[model samples]
Target chain A: MKLFRMLRRHIRDAFKSVFRNFSLSVASITCITITLIIVGLSIIASLNLKNFTTEIEEDVTMIVFLDADTTEEQISTLTVEINSIPNVEEVKFKSKNTSKNEMMQESDFFKETMSTWGEGDNPLKDSFQVKVKDIEKIADTAEEIRDMDKVSVVNYGEEMVNNLISAFSMIQKVAIIMVVALIVVTIFLIINTIKLTIFSRKREISIMRLVGASNVSIKIPFLIEGLILGFIGSIIPIVVIIYGYTALYNHLGGVVYSNLITLIQPEPFVYIASLIILGIGMLVGMVGSAGAVRKYLKV
Target chain B: MDLIRINNVKKQYKNGVTAINNLNLSIKKGDFVFIIGGSGSGKSTLIKMLYREEKPTLGEIIVGGVNVAKLRNRKVYVLRRKLGIVFQDYRLLPKQNVYENVAFALEIIGAKKEEIRRKTLKAIEMVGLKSKIHNYPDQLSGGEQQRVAIARAIVNNPKLLICDEPTGNLDPERSKEIMDILEAINKEMGTTIIMATHDKDIVNRMKKRVVALKDGRLVKDVEKGGYCSEAI
Candidate 1:
C-alpha cells in the first residue's frame, strides 16, 4: 500500500517538475541528442570500413610469370606445386599467347607491339596466378611463392597491398579510439543534464521526504524524466546521420562510381550502426539520472 | 493507564549547556499536559526527545508501551505513524493547498484513496478551513496555516498528538481559537496531548495539567495552570 502511494506521487512529482523546468530540460535533451548522433555516425563508419577492407583483401591475387626455359610438363608440375602451398585458394594458368592477346585487347597501340613480336621467340611465357584464401595472409603467400620452383618472377604490388592492409588496421584503431572518446563525452553531458533537472526539483524532493515518501517512489520520476530526455536526444542524431548520409551519397555518387577500390571508405551500414550507438547514449542518460537522484535522495 | 513514561532523560549540548536533565514523568492516555519553561529552560529539547529526533544522554522513554529511546532508526517511520508532530513554524508545505497538505499525511502512510479524501475533508472542516481548502499555505493567514497544520497532525488519528509551540506563531485571539480547537479534540478523541509552550495566555485559560521547567529542572507541576507573568 505504501509502495503504491509512493509510486503514484513519484509519477506526479516527476511530471510536474519536468514541465516546470522546460527550458533547462530541453538544454539537457539537445546535448544528449548531439552526443548520440556523433557517436552513432562514427560506429556506422567503422563497421562499413571493416566490411570494405575484407572485400578488398579477398580480391588480392598474385601473378607469377614463368621462366622462359620451362616446358609443358614443368609448367603443369609448377601449377600443381603452387596450388599445394598453404593459404592458396586456386592457381589460374595463363599461356604466353593468352597473355599477349589480353594485352592487345587493352588498346590498338598494344596490338601493334604484340603483332611485332616473332612467333617462335615470343618473350611472354605461361604463368600461374595465385589467389589467397584469406586476404590477411596475402603477404605470407607471396613470400612462399617467391621460393617455388619454375617460378621466374612474382608480380603483385607488394607496396600497395601493404599500404592497404595498414590503412585498414589504422581505420579500426582510430574507430575504437573515437568510440571510447565519444562515450566519455556522452556520459559527462548526460550526467550534467540530469544533475540540472535534479537541482530544479530539490524543493519538491524535500516535501516528498518530509511526507515520508519512499526512496523508490522519489527516484522513479526523475529516472523516467532522464530516460525521456535521453530517448529524445538519441533520435535527433539518427535523423542528422540519415540526412547527412543521403546528402553525401547523392553528391558523392560519381566518386563512388569512379573509385571502385573503396576498401577504407565507410558505407551505409555505418549510419545504421551509429544509430545503435545512440542507444548507448540514451542508456548513459538513464543510468546517470538514476545515480544522481539516488545520491540526492539519500533516504 | 500510563501511556508514556520518562525516566531521568538528559540532553547536554556541545556548547556545554544542559538542555534537559534528570527529567522524570509519566503520562496517561487522557492527559492534556503542557510542558512550559523560560526561553532556555530545555522545554523544546524535552519535546524533541519524545520524538527521538534528539536522543537522550541518559535514561529511557517509553511511549504507548514502545521503548522510544532505544527505537531503531529505520523503525522511526513506524513510531512516527502513531505520532503526529506539529511545530511552531507550522511547517506547512508552501506549494500544496490546504486539502493536499492535509491529505499528504495519508499519502505517505498509503491510506485508501476514498478514505484519504473523506478524512482530509473532515479534517479541513474541523479546523474550519473548508472554504479555504484550495488555498496554498502562503495565501492563508498565519492562523489559517496553523489550523491547516493542526488538521494535518490530527488527520491520521494518531495515538499521541505532540504540539511544540503550535500556537506560538498566532496572535491572542488566534491563539485562543487554536487552544479551543485542541481542547475540543482532547475531549472528543481521548488522544494523549503533549504541548510545549512558553505562552502564558493559553496556559491560564486551558485550566489543564501544566508541568513547568526551570534551568533544566522540573520546578512545578500544577493541576490548574495560568500564565507565569510573575516569573517572567
Candidate 2:
C-alpha cells in the first residue's frame, strides 16, 4: 500500500510539473524525439546493410574442376561425397560441354575458344560448384575437394571469401561504434536538459526541503518526469523506423531493378525498433534523472 | 523540563565573521517567547538553527528530543515536521493558491487526503483567509500573505511554532493582526510559540517572556518581559 502511494506521488508530481513548466517540458521532449529518431534510423539502415552483406556471403560458391580423364561415374561420385561434407550445402556439377556452352553465352569470344575443340577432344572438364553454409569455411572445403583424386584443380580463391568476411566484420564494428556514440550523446544531452530544469526549480526544491519532504519524494517525481520525456520522445522515432524501413525496402526493390540486393524481412524491424527505443530511452531517462536528482535531493 | 534548549550555541559566517557567540537559552512548553536582536545580530542564524537549516558551530540544540547540530539531512526534515516556521518574506509559492499552499506542508509529510483537506481548511479559516483560499499569493497583500504563511506553517499542527520576523514586512495594524492570530493559535492549541522580533512596541504590548541578544550574546531572560534598554 505504501509503495503504491509512493508511486502515486511520483506520477502526480511528474504530471503536475510537466503542466507547471509546459514550455521546458515540450522543448525537452522535442530534443529527445529528434535525437532518438536519427538514432533509430541509423540502426535500421545498419541492420539492413548487414542483412544484404550476409545474403551476398551465403550465395558465394567455389567451382572445383575435375580431371579431364575422369568419367561421368567419378564426377557423380565426387559430387555426392562433397555434398556430404559438413556445412557444404549443395554440390552441383556442370559437365565440360555444358560449362563451355554457358561460358560461350556470357561472351561470343568464348565460342571461339570452344570451336577449336573437335568432337573427339573435350576442351573442358566437369566441375563441381560447392556452396557452403558459411563463407568462412569455403577455403577448407575447397582444399578438401582439391585433395580428391577425381579433382584436378580447385578454383575457389581463399582471398575473396576472407575479404568478404573482413568487410562484414568491419561494417559490424562501425555500426556498433556508431550506436555506442549515439547512446552516449543521448545520455549527455538528456542529463544536461534535466539539470537545467532542476536549476530553474531550485527555489521550489528549497521550499520542499524546508517542509522536510523525504529525498525519495523529491527525486522520484523528477525521475518519473525524465521517464515520461524519454517515452514520449521515443514514440516518433519508433513509428518513423517501422514506416521508414518498409519504404526503404520498396524503394530498394524498385531501384535495384535486377533483384540483386536482398532486403531485410519485416520481422527483424521490430527487434531493431525495440532495441533503438528501449536502449536509448531507458538509458537516457534513468541516467539523466539520477544526475539531476542527485543535485537537488541533498541525500 | 524545557521544551527547547540551546546551550552555548555559536554561529560563524564563511568570511570569519561570528554571528552568534556562546548564546544559551531555554523555553518551556506553552511559553510565548520573543527573541529580540538588532540587524546582523544573528537573529536569522539563530532562527535557522532551531529549524536545522544552519547548525551551531559549537553547541548542542535540543528541539523535540533531537540534537539539531548533529542531525543528518534526512533527519532535518523529520525534525521540521514537528516545527512550524514562518518567514519574514512569507515564501509562498507564487503558482499555488492559498489552500494549496497551506495543504502542501501536510502533503509532504504524507497526510491522508481527507485529513489534509480538513486541516488545511481549518487552518485557513483560523487565519480568517477562508474567502481568499482560492487566490494566489501575488493577489494578496503583504499581511494576508503573511497570514497565509502562518496558516501553512501551522497546518501540520506542529508542536512548536517558530516565527522569524513574520511581521517584519507588515504595517503596525497588520503586524498586530498577525500577532493576534498567533496569540489565538497559542491560546487555543496550547502550542509553544517562539517569535523573533525587533518591534519593541508589539513585544512589550504582548506581555510575554522575552529573550534578548546583543553582540551574539544572550543578555536577558525575563518572565512577563518588557523591552528595556538594559538588555541591549
Query: Using TM-score as the measure, which candidate wins?
Result: 2
The TM-score between candidate 1 and the true structure equals: 0.77
Which lDDT tens digits does candidate 2 get at residues A80-127? 888888979987878888877788888879878887876559677778
Which stretches of candidate 1 lie above 4 Å from their native place?
Answer: A1-13, A21-24, A37-102, A115-138, A144-168, A254-278, B1-26, B36-76, B89-96, B168-170, B208-232
> Where is model 2 more than 4 Å wrong at Cα?
A70-121, A132-149, A157-163, A254-260, A266-271, B13-15, B228-232
DockQ of predicted candidate 2: 0.50
Tell me each candidate's i-RMS in Å: 3.6, 2.3
Cα error, residue A160 of model 1, in Å, equals: 4.4
- Predicted structure with the largest DockQ when compared to the true one: 2
Fnat of candidates, each listed: 0.25, 0.48
The 10-residue segment with the lowest total lDDT in model 2 chain B: B223-232
- Give candidate 1's root-mean-square deviation (CA, Å): 4.7
Give the per-residue lDDT digits (tens) of candidate 1, residues B25-97: 9988878999888888888888887876677888899888778889765555566667777888887876578
The Cα local distance difference test for each model comes to 0.78, 0.83
